[model samples]
Target: MNLYNLNPKYRILVTGGAGFIGSNLCESLLANGNTVVCLDNFATGKKSNVTPFLSNKKFTLIDGDIRNLSDCHKACEKVDYVLHQAALGSVPRSMNDPITSNDVNVTGFLNMLVAARDAKVKRFVYAASSSTYGDSKNMPKIEDVIGKPLSPYAITKYVNELYADVFSKTYGLETIGLRYFNVFGRRQDPAGAYAAVIPKFVMQLMNHESPHVNGDGSFSRDFTYIDNVIQMNIKSLVTNNTLAVNTVYNVAYGKRTSLNELLDLLKEYLTEFDLKIGSVKTTYGPIRKGDVPHSLASIEKAKELVGYNPEYNIREGLREAVQWYWNNLK
Candidate 1:
């Protein structure tokens, strides 16, 4: 049974729709008979990521940046909903250049919000981050309780939540903020300074090179799969529960996996393709600046409110993702 059947077809606008998560969302929505408009400047997003969708009659690509209010306004024209995913990611990158990060993540976010409000979209769902729980020593992070942001990137995301709340209250715009925890899956880029751990490690192991562990490998995260995130976004879009609107939810698998455990699982999966990969070792490095020691989300609120039932845990997601990289990128 298609769980998304309850929702009516919508003309959705996905900012940063050429990026990893946005591209996946556009693909799913288009598959389900919805019209999708993708707005991207291609700063961090690649044109190749969206090339496959160009022929789709339902997909429209807008070559524009969110930093420009007119561009955001143009993208929001007649759109039913907005899934704002475009932003400069990576704490280290933000630390190095806080100005650009603030411009794209903060100012750009505000532009999207104003556009959505003017367009009168049914709902505005934006990607928040687990880094919002920065510096908090909590084991399982709850949505309501968050620690002060430790980095400029974290600060920008936290500010997004604040802005969303204010917009919902002041402008009567329906909004939902999803604080994603370590999302990884297909189309996730593996070649970048700020590449995510799963794809980065998979690429390294495939090349028979030693993967670098940022810490003792004991640091853990509640890694959520991209499909699960897509589900949450869909649910947020269609949920009739008024309580679910105008609130934030932690989108995660509700389980924690250490970096060491993750590497071991990667080896197990990739070794089936090439047995020599099993012998590849990992090199340890100093802990990264602005990195949280541990992260685990309490998804009780998401489940009770938005009916979020994640379909994949870490191992299941990794199996699918590893196979994707092996077949496509390797």
Candidate 2:
């Protein structure tokens, strides 16, 4: 799909626009000549992420919390579309603090949906989680078949799908849910206890520190690239296909790589920058709670429905991510 082929400029509202995924979306949208309104509380979002866009006349930054209904309403004003990316995103974080997770992921999500519906936006595309595929040993996860949620975070995301479905039926709001897998790339933070595995490993290996493997290095994930995710979100917004609305799609690379394989790739890439990184060994620990053994995506549904053709695989995406880290973070 050609991202630049979008016909008319749109006024888009991206919640959590100061966060990794949201910031990337904002950059892409602005490059494509669209006006962007970003809503972020800076709780988990960093100001450095959106700092570059501060000078853009087409960009507006709203320092607000998604937990507050007024902030949601304020962000949705005069916006054509809403890409809802705001949420507390770590499984372990949710397991530790279920109340806050529910309040943000579930209640905050509801606030966005209500604001979008009330504002009469053209579409509402929110971030969903692959964690919702809990306990279903399905090799290539499809959209229809989902198991019970394994954690409070997963529970909240699943409830988002339910609420979005209800809103589409009850209020006729156009909605789509992108169930993202282990998405990683440039600007993804490498610090914090809840940092994603790819960035964490890259940061650790860069510092000549041994990164810990949560299991016997057997667990695998469909490590999707941020560019592929951007394609999906843009397609979700501009697609005129009637069948594409009010549904969820798997946003992933449609391939899985084990932690052992992943670590090897990181070392191989980082070693090019510093030979010592190759010698950094890994420390293995017991599997963490609320984690599945494997995750792969059946992106066929997305391919068939929304014309989603992912542009990057694991190695291609990883190499790019490594280069980005080496240039920007190192």
Candidate 3:
């Protein structure tokens, strides 16, 4: 186990701090006695996500856009570290509106990097996606080997890492990227058209509707839980390991769960609430473009470097997530 020498009086900045993962990060930091400044434009983020933190004296909210350099500058002021989570996610959505996605995910990310560099932030940690591993057939993907990006969203995330590396070499800014794989949990909005699978499935089950499975339902993914992601962010902020700096890590459970098995599991868990909900008849659609058949992460590097240990598998994480949606969202 690796121990981080964290500063007790650090003030950290979290961009997109009102979104699902960002909100959780903010909450965890405040609980640990750190002062947190959250910058969010609420583009995809909701105000309610950060409402609970308003009462915390250690928490400060900055309503701003990352695309605006001034807003990024203002947010980074006096911050020790930055956890950049702001981005336009989803492959299909990006395929639909590539230009807007590029503006927010690419240009906006660059803006944050420049601001963080100028502010001399200790480290700029940003969210890079496993989508960057596009077209790579290698199982348990290693960071060193990646294929060409398959979508506009993938292109944007890949660009974030590319720019981070360039900035580190050029301006001497410390940066780390976490390549997140199918992250799911509470506050993940299920109402949107481009909602993630877990929340969307849970919502559909709550509505007593048949969940649609794209492709043959054999498509697998390394579905990571939110709490694990929270751990990675905290570790990235405080780790003083020289070898750990200016690199990327895979934030995942290092296990793959298939869609067919996932649907069955969802039905099984939801059945506890309503026994009438038996085997759900799922509708299969054509395989979506830019989606790989399976995704699994080789987390040895993260484990060795920053002591990244994932505590939840898909079933355990989904069980908790389903219960949350049932009690709060239903």
Candidate 4:
């Protein structure tokens, strides 16, 4: 699915454009012939991610922080749409420093919302999270139904939806929130303590080290691929459906994979490059706090509303990601 070909290109501002998912969005937009201005403070985003686009005539990188209103205003200048991806991610990180997480995720989000509203962008599409589903034990998580936030990071993301809702209602700004599941793919950072499961495991397995599974390895998640997420963002950006506007959709592959199953797939894919990766053992640990046992999204809302059809499932995405890491990061 070539999403860029489906809509008329416009000048877009991508906050956190130097991050994993943000860089991919910038690349896709630029490839489709849209002008892109990227704003980043490099707090969690890496400069290498945007270095490839520095030479593009249509690409501009603004060294700025989303927490500052002035920076948000500067980034939003003359932008047609805002794909707000800037936020402090990871539940463990949030648990460690709730104050900083709230400041960046909540306050920074409001800054972007106000700036986008003032700039009069066509629409504001921000990254929400599956963590917002919290303790809801529902197998196939839906949009409307939610539970109490399990961690500070989840609280911050949920607050973003509330603020976006109010901004749309009170200020007449067009907004869409995509509740992303456990998103993973190429360029996803695996070095940090908050590194995602896939990349972390891939790196560990690549080094012939034991990858640790939290708990009995039965805890599952709707591990979404970056390409599918990009599709959802583009769909949210271009969709003219009245009902879809000012709403949230689950951005996921609509399937769940257990931790043990995830390791098997990663090994299967990575072993093609180095046979030793297949023999790497895994260690099990107690499940961390604020961690849910299972998470799966009902992407029917996205399919019905934004025409989201994920082309890459777990196996397909993991194959590409493992290859990228092997070639680039190995």
Q: RMSD in angstroms, candidate 2?
A: 1.1
Cα error, candidate 1, residue 319 (Å): 0.4
Candidate 3: segments with Cα more than 4 A from true spot: 1-8
RMSD list, candidates in order: 1.0, 1.1, 1.8, 1.1
**Native-to-model Cα distance after best TM-score fit, residue 305 in candidate 2, in Å:** 0.7
Go through the candidates in order and give each one's C-alpha lDDT: 0.94, 0.94, 0.90, 0.93
TM-scores for every predicted model: 0.98, 0.99, 0.97, 0.98
Candidate 3 vs candidate 4: the lDDT winner is 4
Candidate 4 weakest lDDT stretch, 10 residues: 1-10
lDDT tens readout by residue for model 2, 1-330: 236366447899999999999999999998888899999999899999999999999999999988999999999999999999999999999999999999999999999999999999999999999999999988899999999889999999999999999999999999999999999999999999999999999999999999999989999999999999999999999889999999999999999999999999999999999999988989999999999999999999899989999999999999999999999988
As for candidate 1, its clashing pairs are none
The sequence of per-residue lDDT tens digits that candidate 3 reaches over residues 1-330 is 222445557899989999999998888788777889999999899999999999989899999999999999999999999999999889999999999999999999999999999999989999999999999989889999999899999999999999999999999999999999999998999988899999999888778788888899999999999988988877887777889988999999999999988888888898899875665578899999888889999999999998888889898999999898889997
lDDT tens digits by residue: candidate 1, 1-330: 243763436799999999999999988888887889999999888899899999999999999999999999999999999999999999999999999999999999999999999999999999999999999888799988888899999999999999999999999999999999999999999998989999999999999999999889999999999999999999999899988999899999999999999999999999999999999999999999999989999999999988899999999999999999999998
Instruction: List ranges where model 1 is wrong by over 4 Å.
Output: 1-3, 6-8
Candidate with the greatest lDDT versus the true structure: 2
Off by over 4 Å in 2: 1-4
lDDT over C-alpha atoms for residue 126 of model 3: 92
